[model samples]
Target: MSPRKKIVQAAFEKKKLNGVVARVGLVLDISGSMRNLYLNGTVQEVVERILAVASKFDDNQTLDVWIYDNEFSRLPSVKENGIENYVAKQILNNETLHKFGRNNEPLVMEDVIRKYTKEEPSTQPAFIVFINDGGVVKPTKKVIVESSTLPIFWQFVGIGNSDFELLRKLDEMEGRFVDNANFFHLDDISAISDENLYDHLLHEFPEWLQAVKSKGLVL
Candidate 1:
């Protein structure tokens, strides 16, 4: 019922999403910098809004949720029921300092790529929403470039006032099979219009989907 939630749901409804091959994934940055966002409830609202979008994807309306700093840990999927309490508890109860001060995206990506490929091995492309405060390392760029050929689209949403220098560079850094990564530096996430935010969030995904399919990356 919040504006952000309305925007996410409306944007999803506006898209011709039927038959779109997608598996939803939400990656939350639990770094020390993100602690304030968690305390102030922005992260919870974000999870709920994204969960609203994820529900449209499958019968269970569930999304894979992961929290990462230098490493990553998979949490219970965000389902349609009790989502708010579920998300809040996950953030509130966790050790915020778990491998603190590091945002090794490559480690997380490797885990996701390996787990999904071996366990599921489906052709459905994954839409990974990576929430962070702009701590992408050099190896992340290499891993991203290497993984561009895989069936996954990475949308990096930068929260807070950080410059997101590396993320911006990654956005313009090219020569992949297709543009698999998109970046947004949000000055005030709560103030953003849902329409605009969702537009940015979903914009590059459809194109990437087509490109991957055409290249025989997604069968």
Candidate 2:
């Protein structure tokens, strides 16, 4: 085997996933559309799995949860949520711009950008997972464009049948676009299973992670 393969094997033997991580910033679409049961579970199921898996990374990583909508634009900030807030503000910006409430208080995309441009932070390494139904309002594009430049690494997963085409397109050109790769996916939840989710996440997560780190970002 190659020397690199030998080294990795030895590392695995020693149970060292040093650079490989577990904690992550999970963003799910709690919009009205998510309630449309696409599979055995709604998009919520995926978020649950994400949280569960993060727990396994206890030694190396932690998972933070953030949900978005108008009245509930954020699911308690990750900062206050107790996990590292490296990407909290960026997620908040994307949340406000790229999301509308399922019920109340709509904050336009410009609002998020106007806020972010005024304050930029160090780009941290993070598994920015976006679970959305591409049904956001049109004007939100401004928010998307503005905040899109913020994240250093991402895992954009689209749930349901919302124009996967458009959703994938709005993503950064060099952005963390997963194009159905393991880290990223276009899931029709109705036809999926937990096992399927677990296996894919396990198999695909590592490589996408490697790609993100290759860019020289820190999580």
Superposed on all Cα atoms, the candidates' RMSDs to the truth, in angstroms, are 2.6, 9.5
lDDT of 2 by residue, 31-129 (tens): 656544422244444544565455444334355555566643335423323433333344433534444347221252333233223443434434445
lDDT (C-alpha, whole model) for all candidates: 0.77, 0.45
| lDDT of each residue in 83-162, candidate 1, tens digit only | 76665677567655263456778887787777567777777888889988866777888878888888888999998787
Return model 1's CA RMSD, one decimal: 2.6
Clashes of 1: 0
Q: In candidate 2, which residue pairs clash? A: 23-61, 23-62, 38-190, 39-189, 39-190, 69-101, 70-101, 71-104, 125-218, 125-219
Q: Which residue window of length 10 is worst by lDDT in model 1?
A: 94-103
Task: Name the lDDT of candidate 1.
Answer: 0.77
Candidate 1 Cα deviation (angstroms), residue 210: 1.0
